[model samples]
Target: MRPLIAIPARFSARTSALRYAAEVNARSLIEAVWRAGGEPVGIHPADTGTAARLARFDGVLLPGGGDLAPPATAPPTPTTPSTTSTPSRTPSTSTSPGTPWSRACPCSRSAAASRP
Candidate 1:
């Protein structure tokens, strides 16, 4: 039996075929999964009983496309010019299971300096 892959459908305000708001998934993604010998299933984006429903599927494919919101407590902006500066340091590399290698700066430096 082929593995069942659960795909979370992307929600859009308006689509060309459907004039009203609708939940949809990419056709290419579903076809690719099927070609790879996996059964692709569309899942509703509801919070209720999601964990129980997903238990039946062998794997999950989370496609991007969602709203983003800033944190409630905003960081304080610097008003005064800084006189001192720290030297740039190289980022350290690490790897985890089933994930690509990642690089991160040491925690000793300021957040702004760490950003690429």
Candidate 2:
């Protein structure tokens, strides 16, 4: 079966409140996939039938994006709060593990292909 890839694109109006939106351009990714011998399909998040369509593809990829609310494994407060002083405490921020977003495409390169 010829490999098919689906790339997710989320474009917003220029004045939106996004601090650092994802920079994974769909056209570029699709081009790369084609050059690598896979059939790439670009998809948008608002596409209602994405799931049904992706079901026909080989694999699903979650591309790079801004951080979401931290995972629910944070540590609990160690000390009890006193009535007099404004409860002294510090909240922590979580960062992603810096995993490179895998480009979703098919594994189509053959063993005999010349290495560039």
Considering every candidate listed, which one attains the maximal TM-score?
Answer: 1
- Please write out the lDDT profile of model 2 over residues 1-116, one tens digit for every residue: 45776666666554246665553455555556666666766566664655566666654333445652222222333543233322112212212222122222343233114234
- Which window of 10 residues has the lowest lDDT sum in candidate 2? 85-94
TM-score versus the correct structure, for each prediction? 0.52, 0.41
TM-score of 2: 0.41
The TM-score measured for candidate 1 stands at: 0.52
The top-ranked prediction according to lDDT is 1
Off by over 4 Å in 1: 66-116
